[model samples]
Target chain A: MKVLVIGAAGMVGRKLVAALLAAGQINDKAISSLTLADVVEPSGLGIDIAHTVIATDLSEEGAAASLIAERPDMIFHLAAIVSGEAEADFEKGYRINLDGTRALLESIRLASQSEPYCPRLVFTSSIAVFGEPLPAVIGDEFQQTPLTSYGTQKAICELLLSDYSRRGFVDGVGIRLPTIAVRPGKPNKAASGFFSGIIREPLAGLEAVLPVADTVRHWFASPRAAVGFLLHGAAMDTAQLGSQRNLSMPGLAVTVGEQIAALERVAGPKAVALIRREPDAVIADMVAGWPKAFEAKRARSMGFVGDASFDEIIEIHIADELSGKVAL
Target chain B: MKVLVIGAAGMVGRKLVAALLAAGQINDKAISSLTLADVVEPSGLGIDIAHTVIATDLSEEGAAASLIAERPDMIFHLAAIVSGEAEADFEKGYRINLDGTRALLESIRLASQSEPYCPRLVFTSSIAVFGEPLPAVIGDEFQQTPLTSYGTQKAICELLLSDYSRRGFVDGVGIRLPTIAVRPGKPNKAASGFFSGIIREPLAGLEAVLPVADTVRHWFASPRAAVGFLLHGAAMDTAQLGSQRNLSMPGLAVTVGEQIAALERVAGPKAVALIRREPDAVIADMVAGWPKAFEAKRARSMGFVGDASFDEIIEIHIADELSGKVAL
Candidate 1:
């Protein structure tokens, strides 16, 4: 199966590529070729499959058309301006997140008009689609009223994905992933970066700042689980998704205190003590508006899985990112 | 206050224009000017206010920018391709319904960049935004999973409206109007056209076809009430609307049987007998998925009103459309 992964340079994108190469196949079909595209050329892949990497901006006119010219059997779209960046630069956010996604959908649609083509397009939506005034446990039927520009962009893309799928332009599946915890890399500037930092930094035997209160709770999944969601979404029967093409994937909902305890259990008190409690009201208010837990019955019923606990998430990070060995 | 109506030639748009002219002012401010636009030139309005009528396709490039150049203090955007038309022609549907609306919003946003220009943009959304597997009564926060392309377009526009408003690009308000009953003028080919035809034709001493069963229940509002909704939405304080600018307007929910009973009371047994049962499975299936009733507490709390009952709806039709007289 020929596959194309947009935004293939990002954290999840790189991991997903590795996972695909490791398996050597998807849905039991051998990977014949792969095409990777992003603003910056993706590197460090040691795959033997016929592959090509290109640096391109999908939002530019005709950019999406050029990408779809190859007509890959499956496309994984994970390109988006992160929340904080989108919120700061409104025009760039809408351009890259909203317009870019639309261009891609339109490209696929126009391509279908010329020939019999319906690619399995798996899009990565975000939990940011849900915002303040949320229910204690967000259900499958909760309304999407995103408070941030990034959230709004993702929400719009979800709507477009469903509409396009319903119209038979593309076979689309949107997975609203939880914040990836213990993200394996250097800490980024995202407000939710701390969710991973508190664990990843400690596991690496380094200091990490805890921005919010211990009572603060959030839904999480390891990067490994996120990649799993993409694979499952690519292979699943979209007929089961009905008219709503988007699904909020299952996640391990845990409090900061619970996360700390898990870290302590795994790496001893030294690792837990590395987390220093330092309050930042701006980040605190932003975190407070985020979803804590979700009743993702629809996604679960459809067989999409996640880490059962924070401990499992940490373990996955250690096994995958640290080669099953922590600094301690 | 200067006002601009994008769909001044349509049923509710004409009524809204009439209502505005009758009031001579909005929010106690004098109606200094009125700019009206539509696909076809609107005619036969004897208004003394400085007004201009133009036939324009909003989806065309530069059209929206031209309209916003005047920068009317209040803008009522009600332009759209109807449901059946949108379903039949996908490109035209997205072009006019989705792209057209976005064009208008973008024009306003760009204009604002040059100078401070946040106009009151009151948009006309529809109940079609909600589809099947619905609760007995849809609430203010029900998920929008539109089954039809028209509904999808409207739902997408609602998301864009909220996002633009939240970003301070435009002061926007979106009202999801229920099926406008007892519509004046010739019946169009819309499946839901029967809802108005069943009552309108009999009142005019003509036979009407009932395509769906009497047990089928749906939401309703008179053309007069729809006009009222626009006026109220325009003049009301939007400070309380928060980030979610779209509202499901209050409506009378009654079964087709109840509507028939009310018609019989308003006219006579002879008028009721004018209705002929003609089941069309296509329309019946479509109607089956429509919302029956809504718990529009948010709109009600904000002082938006609707007909109390089917009897009141019939009364409104007679008063507004039939010159306060029904053919007995």
Candidate 2:
């Protein structure tokens, strides 16, 4: 089985590529070739597989058609502009997120008309799909009323994916991933970036700003688990999904205080002390509307795994990104 | 205020046009001109209002831009291919329902850029947005996991409406209308046609087929009520909607048995005798996945009126379509 990974240059996409190459197969089907695509050509995808890396923008005319021309057996679409950028530049967000995904689906449909072609499509959605007036624990069936253009784009793509899949044009699974914690990278200015920075920076002996209070709760998963979700979405028995092709993946719900407690458990007081408290009301207000927790019963029943705790999420980050080492 | 009705030729559309002409205004604003657009020219529009009737398909390349060129102050976008047809023809369904609506939105946004222009965009969504695994009484926050392509299209439109409205590109309101009963028309092959047929045909002294069991329940409103929902959508204070611009319009939920009883009560047993049970499993299975009832607290609280009972729904048909006289 050949595999195509869009947004292969991004953190999760890169990890997914490495995992796919490490396994050398999906569901015991021998992987033959790979196509790695992004806005910039993906690099250093180890020499174990026959692969081609293409720098492509999906929303451009004929871009999706060209990408699907080779017809990979499984496709993982993870391309998106971050929420801050999408909200700031409305036109660009719709073009890249909404039009791009729709173009890919349309291209696949057109390709299928030539002969028979139905590939397994795994799309990465986000918990941003859920908005304010949320329940304490959002069950498997909460409405998707995204409050941002980025979230709206994801929700729209999920609908398109389900409709296209139901029509037999493709086999699609959309997994709404939690906010990945301990994201293995330097902190940027994203409001939610603090979720990862408060862990990653402190582990590196760097003081990280804590914008919200200790009681600010949110859903989280490790980057490793997010990649696992993509794989599971690729290989799962879609028959169990019935008509609803999209699902919110299981995740750990933790408050800032709980996260700090986990940090203390994992790396002691030194790492925990590195988090500097600096209240920013703007970020706090935005975070308040986010989904705090989810039941995710359907995804769990379908065999998708969740991290045991915030400590486990941190452990995975250290193992994968820091080579199991802490600066202290 | 100038008004444009995109589907002035459809069942509810024709009724809406008639009501608008009769009122000569909306929310006390003196109505000026009208633009009636559809796949075919809408004819016989009352000359009380100066109007332009255009035969236009919204999915066409420049149709939406042309429609919005004059920029009517309030637009009612009620055009769509029905459920069964959208399911049968995939491409056409996406073209007409999905792309057409998106085009209209994009056009409106572009028009706004030239000058300050934000129209009251009242879109007619359907309860088809909600599907099975449904609660006995679906609440305002129920997930929109539609089982069919038509429902999927409507749900997508609702998302776009909310997003666009939130962004200040348009002042939009989407009302998810219930299954309109006692339709004033000839019998049709649509799966849910029986919902209207049993009442419409019987009242006209004609035989009507009942495909599903008596216990099979569904949500409904009358032609008059459906038209009222549209008018209210156009005239209501959208600020009350907050970021959620869509709503499930209130309607009566009744079983087929209750419908027949209402028919008996309204036109006596002679009219009820005109109904014949055919027991179509295909239609039955399809109907099974449909939403039964909704709490509709949100729409109700917003001052949108609902049909009092199934008996009122039947009475509406007689008063409006039958000229207050049943043929029995």
Candidate 3:
């Protein structure tokens, strides 16, 4: 099977590409060719299989058509303008996120007109699709009432995916992923950046800021598990999804306290001591409206797995990024 | 306040126009001008204050911009490619229903750029947004996993409305109308057309086909009540809506047997006898996936009302369509 991974330059995207190259197959079918695309050129890392990297803007006219011209059998769409950026710039957000996704779907549908083609499309959605006055644990049946522009874009894209799939233009599996923890890299300015920074910085024997109270709970999955979800979504029998093409992927629910406890268990108290407490009111107010957990019944039933616990999540980060050892 | 009705030729739109002209004001604000637009020119209808009608398609280039140029203070966007047509023609469905709505929104946002003009935008959505695996009664929080292309378009529009409102671009209120019962017109090819056909044809002293079983249940609101919902949606304080701009309007849930019983009570057995039962397996299968009832608590709390009962719904049709008497 040939595959195209859009948004292949980002952290998760790069990780997914590496994993795909390592496995060299999806659903037991060998990966014969790979096409990676993003706004900036993605590195194939000189992998052996037939590899190609292209830098393209999906919102640009004819960009999606060119990408869909060859029509790789499996497509992973992970590209998105992040939440803060989308919220800050409305038109840009709608252009890149909403229009970009629509362009891709339209191109695919148009491509299948002459030849009968239905590629397996795996779209990454976000928990931001659910907003304020949420339940303690949001069920799979909960409506998507997105409060932010970014969430709205993702929700709309999910709808398009379902409709396109229903029309038999594409075989789409949209997984609403949880917040990825222990995101390997420098601490970013995103409000949710603290979730990973607290764990990552401390593990690296560097001081990190804790902006909210320890009771600030959220749903989380390791980057490795996120990649696992994409693979499962790509390979799964979509007939099981029926009319509902989207699912909230399973994730471990934990609070700041739980994450700290896990860190203490894995590393010593000294490693945990690198944390600094500081309350940020703006972030707290925003996080108040965020989803803390999900039932994710459908995805779990479909064989998609999540991290066992925060300990496992931290361990995955340690093994993957830290060379199996915490700097502390 | 200047008003613009986008789908002014439709049944509800015409009634709303008549109601507006009769009252000569909305929410105690004197109407200054009226602009009625549709794919076909809507009659400015003779007895009116400053009126204009335009035959235009929203999907066309610069059409939405031209409409927004005048910047009417209140806008009623009731246009859509109906369900069956949309399902049959996929590209046309997206082009008109989805892209048209987006164009209107984009124009509104751009109109705001020169001078901040936030119009009262009352968008009409539908119950088709919900699908199968439904609970006995869907609540305000039920997920919208539409089984059809039309439903998907409405769901996406609803999300857009919410996001636009959240950004303060437009004061938008999207009401998901129940199936309008006893729709004052010829029965069309819509699978759900029978819902109105049974009530309408019987009252008109004509034979009507009942394609589904008497046990089949569905949600409905009278044309008068639907117009009432629209007017309320246009005038009500949107500040009360918060971030969730869309609502499932209150409707009477009745089984086909209940509709027959109500028909009998309203216009006697002779009128009820006009309904000929011919169970259609295709229609039965379609109706089975529709939403039966809703806990429209949000709309109800916001003072939007529904028909008192199925009898009231029938009476509404009789009084409004038959001049207070059944044709039978």
lDDT for every model?
A: 0.92, 0.93, 0.93
- Give the number of colliding residue pairs in candidate 1: 0
**Ten-residue region with minimum lDDT total, candidate 3 chain B:** B43-52
Candidate No. with top DockQ: 3
Candidate 2 residue pairs that clash:
none
lDDT of 1 by residue, B258-325 (tens): 99999988888888999999999999998999999999999999999998888888888888778887
Off by over 4 Å in 3: none
**TM-score ranking, best first:** 3, 2, 1
Clashes of 2: 0
RMSD of every candidate to native, in Å, equals: 1.3, 1.2, 1.1
Among all windows of ten consecutive residues in candidate 3 chain A, which has the lowest summed lDDT? A43-52
lDDT of 3 at A17: 96
Q: Interface RMSD (C-alpha) of each candidate? A: 1.0, 0.7, 0.6
Error of 3 at A263 (Å): 1.3
| DockQ score for candidate 3 | 0.92
Any residue pairs clashing in model 1, and if so which?
none
